[model samples]
Target: MRVLIWKDGENHLIFNMLPGSGPDYNSVVELSLGQALIAGGGFSSWTYRSGFDVSLPVYSPMAAQLDSQQIAVQDRPWVVISSQINIHPEYTQELAHLAQEHSELLVLEACPSMQSSNYSMRCRGDEVYHYPQVLKRAKFCLVIRGARLGQPSLMDAMAAGCIPVMCADSLVMPFEDVIDWKRAAIFILEENLNSLMEVLSSVSDEHVSEMQVQGSWLYQSYFSSINAVTQTTLEILNDRVFAQRARTFEDWNLPPNPLAARSPLFLQLTAPRSQGFTAVILTYDRVESLFLLIQKLAKVPSLNKILIVWNNQRKSPPHSSMIPKIDKPLKIIKTTANKLSNRFYPYEEIETEAILTIDDDILMLTADELEFGYEVWREFPDRIVGFPSRTHVWDNVTMHWKYESEWTNQISMVLTGAAFHHKYWSYLYTTAMPGNIKEWVDQHMNCEDIAMNFLVANVTQKAPIKVTPRKKFKCPECTNTEMLSADLNHMMERSQCIDRFSAIYGYMPLQTVEFRADPVLYKDTFPEKLKRFNDIGSL
Candidate 1:
């Protein structure tokens, strides 16, 4: 009785039934298997039942009325239940009693439909005070199914960036197969309604924030409009028929899977790891420091080629004859504009898969340290591996991503000022980075390192690696007033970049790790000759 009717097959199978009188009973049973977005739980008949596997749930399209579509981060402190008092009277009474017992925890819901007998009464109007506004205020929304199978509240809660607690056990949610709801929602059995408060209490504010972000992203991507919902349903069906073509879980989630950057089935190492890496140095006007950096990098045994990204458009780089001759073949790329992003442009000359993105002024790193970082990169080809590191901490008080520079054991990003990443990332940086991050970095003439880190972490869902010890990576010798951090406002601008990048991504994609890679004999008592990386800056 179950078969794909609209499906194309080389076998060309056909079915015949008694000439249609609104489709014969047995024939109709067979046709139920056709691809369709059926509403009202298609068929109660024993012979012709369609389940979640064969049909998509069709909820009446409804949206929350908000003044603006902008999704701003907010602190939510209470667990809210929004069901009509008549919908589930007994459960409502139990919830009301629970709220009364733990006043601060249950907090607000004083509007007419959700008003409890003992709870304080406060409302702008009879409703949940614009309904969506109440959801925005709540940390978790208790989603218990109403008299019907589908409810509009679940979508509404997610649309407002409120994490939904799915208390409705057997109800099939929209796009259940394609969307990993566990990432955005919590599931609780209806029989366990009494323990609702206990469950909601256990979730921390950080976790609550992440779930809300995920929920909002899911709503906007797949369920924002009726057309979008319909398209998602069809795409799910198409993926089922052509399983190989289906997007991976990471693609659907849009970043690192927390398991691995590439996931269950990924290539071991795709970067040009076997060959030595190309040294890409960006410079503006620091002629002496630029030549000194080039001379130092040229001595590294693992270096393949040297590309001087001469960002100083006003003056062409010291002529080829004037350029210092080195052991490695050197090429100077004179750019059209003085953009920080120019260093990441995927040029035709880049033949290798791994690129070493370092700045002209960074001269503290030793040759041994560069080799060690390249070796680490070979093992983790898809990650950003380098010397300098930075962390992005969520500032609850400011409600934004705070750029933390104080050294800690943890690292979320490795600055490109002296980092090695796969050349493939250059393609993504110029073409596929999520938002206006490239343009932003170029326009401001700042935070290009942060923007590059965000793009890599966003795609890899993995934290960059920090090798060797790092104090400050500034020049041991001269000072330049033209440097990006010459003013008091430079630090503040970097902090704002983190917040802006996260906003464009729709969620925070940066991952932090307490992991650091050091040379095997880095801190050994053995003689200087015993250590391969003896010149690495003090641990």
Candidate 2:
């Protein structure tokens, strides 16, 4: 194995390790650079302490240049250990012992001091240029802690597509929140130093192959350059801004009820079954599911009206007989726009205090669930309340939201069912849609539910609440075909929608919302005392 070292400042000198220099020892070089303090001591600068310190800053450009000269894994050495001056001598002794015990392992130990038992005497001036080549040929690179963490070796190993064996216990890996280091690197405790060979031997060839692949991915995603650090810093700043805004909202102490609650007859007018709340269902060709949903909703005595927005492209409407004959008023409104984006079109005509949006395919939502959701909306009328909520934003890699099962107050989006106050709906309806909404809808990327969630959260200065139901509701059509397909184009469009929302609002919607446990429902149904105010005849 050969090691390359470059000294950048005065003489642009390069150092190289010669082959057969010794039996069990390699050549390691050290180069020092200057340090400085900048920006009123907020950030302190440091000098290059290791060969990797100088190499990593230019790793991408240099690696690209060396990519064409890549060597197969079978051609590389069994192991490579480039030790710095600060590495404890005990670690060196262990390496020497391991090399002698396993001569077939072909360990290459490089150090500035050539003091080991099997010391390599030759050191060429151009080894720095071949560092990438050396790394490409090695199966594993030893990463040991020195003055600070062994980040340079870890990073260099990854950049060269070598599996890193990290011997630093306290070292903090970058972007731990997003990157799973265990999958990409081997971590060995100090106490396990004697068993180092055993540990390496225990790893299956398949696992090593996986680690090599993941190490390369990890380097490109995070350790390649300063971009990862900048992204992480920006994320922290975004969180701080969100926290400040949340604190401001906490201080305001706005009443839970919307402005409409101040009316003298507000209690009677907004009571369940008094036409206080309207159930809005959006349908697109699923007439059977639509009829079933209407039937279930009609059984709930508290609902005053059920408005079905027919968004199917078919020219002919379903026969009136297909619609369930329910006691509550059922009005089917036809729309020229067949897109799901038109789900909010009925918001303009809603005179009720609040509106409940349900999907046409929801099969098992009970009357108690609707009443429970309605009660939650009344208490937090400033927020959009819903079930089947997701707390995390969609991961671009996995294309799935994190923490999907748990209910969160700071929900990014809610699915299937959502309840909103009429005043809030009016605000959204009045707000002009983004100029690109048409294009978004045409591309099948228009998410009315997520858009509404963002709107309510932005306007109300509060995160939307996911109202937990007394009994879980089931939907046969829960997993849509487009979602199941996971088409890259569709995913890109969804990301674009979120980006557009953030660009227009001056803040990312996902960061602004706060996350908390699901709000508790005090009672399963609307209180019996409020039934006297019901103007519609009971079921």
Candidate 3:
């Protein structure tokens, strides 16, 4: 690959690309131009002396034609650095020493005079044409910051499919919001120059390969030419506006689905047996909290059955002695495994049409909220309905998740403190659970909530509805609890879930404008609120 710098007037500048003529003419870079000057010129006098004047016509059509040419990637293994000016003399000297110590490394110093111990002088006359050849055989290209932030050398390295080693600590790459620089490039602080070789060697071959591929893809997608960059920038701005508007509930005009009439699922169970919903509580070592939660449920007349899933890895006696007689029927199921996914085990025994999954520590959740969630679930029986909803948007450029508040109709995920119909549970059991549940449990991924939301959207052709709570519920016991380190492994798994859904369904699982109805309020039944006692034995 060859970079042709064209100076237009005294300010404007343009760049063009040309195919390599021969092995000797591997890469061409010209820096003594207006663009470099406007970007805080740091070029030395030697750079101007080495600059070549091309008689080729300088016009927009010709430049566009050249930029459209395919970038040629070479199988290179050496690390190449070609700079006429020494912006950081100390770092340059160390690089020269490194080249001498490593056979696979090459350094081309084009200063006024060679000041290093074993540095080779810049190639003279036509020998300089072999610059591209040296770059072609290099696996990594060193792009040190000069006088400014935006450096063309970084783009040059990416164009040749060479992994860029950025040495500017404060430099922010172009299109950063849309592109994750860490995945495509390596960044080292200027102060870390002494250990540059060690740092380079630490990167595994697989990681290097992935970076190279991602760098090439990024260049083609966003940095191929000035026009391409401009178009991508506009698209990014538009996307941000679209996301913000969606979150603010602006221009949300989707008609309510008349087909979303309440299903007979909940009414059928509660009509004869007064068992509208089954409440599943997941507990682990928090026996006191579990007993308090059960007591709260016993006060609600709407609750039909309660299932307490005791998940204590240690063999401990059941705490059934704390149970107090109430109108609602109660059952306890104990498991030796501490799998967080055990919250879903009650699906098989859920005689009620709808199920409400709640954490054992949520003490302030009133019976009204559960009943409201049940009403919302009835309208969208195929969709998961819950409180505490979150919307996630995937940034293609950065390869990261962007979260937002649950909008009118679109919800990316919902917390387990929600209600869903039994049919949705069966859908997950049949589609995503057969062969994958064990691996998920073994990973200690506490993202079963996130996974269930994704699966619900995948199975149902609609986004989940997040019911807004009339009043906030407080979980005093859960306020300061820290999750285990093993539970922090959800990011990778969530990304995988998004990838799988996109691959199978041909689009991302981002929910857009959907209708959200106001939560129905029910009168409180118990005049005296049940509170958690300090001692578990006292209960």
- Best by lDDT, which number? 1
TM-score of 1: 0.52
Q: How well does candidate 1 match the true structure, expressed as C-alpha RMSD?
A: 12.4
Error of 1 at 508 (Å): 0.7
True-structure Cα RMSD, model 3: 19.8
Candidate 2, residue 5: Cα displacement in angstroms equals: 99
In model 2, what is the error at residue 519, expressed in angstroms? Answer: 8.8
Q: Using Cα atoms with residue i matched to residue i, what is each candidate's TM-score against the true structure?
A: 0.52, 0.42, 0.42
Judge candidate 2 against the unseen true structure and give its global Cα lDDT, from 0 to 1. 0.55
For 434-538, candidate 2 gives per-residue lDDT tens digits of: 555444654573556556666665655566665543224445555555232245565555556666666666765553355433324333366655543222211
Q: Rank the candidates by lDDT, best first.
A: 1, 3, 2
lDDT of 1 by residue, 36-143 (tens): 433222222232223334223333233536332434434554565453223456666766777678654442344665436522233433433445555666777777
lDDT of 3 by residue, 30-144 (tens): 4455443111112222222221221110111212222323333334556555443445677768777776787666666553344553223344322342333344456677877
RMSD of each: 12.4, 18.3, 19.8
Candidate number that wins on TM-score, 1 or 2: 1
Index of the highest-TM-score prediction: 1
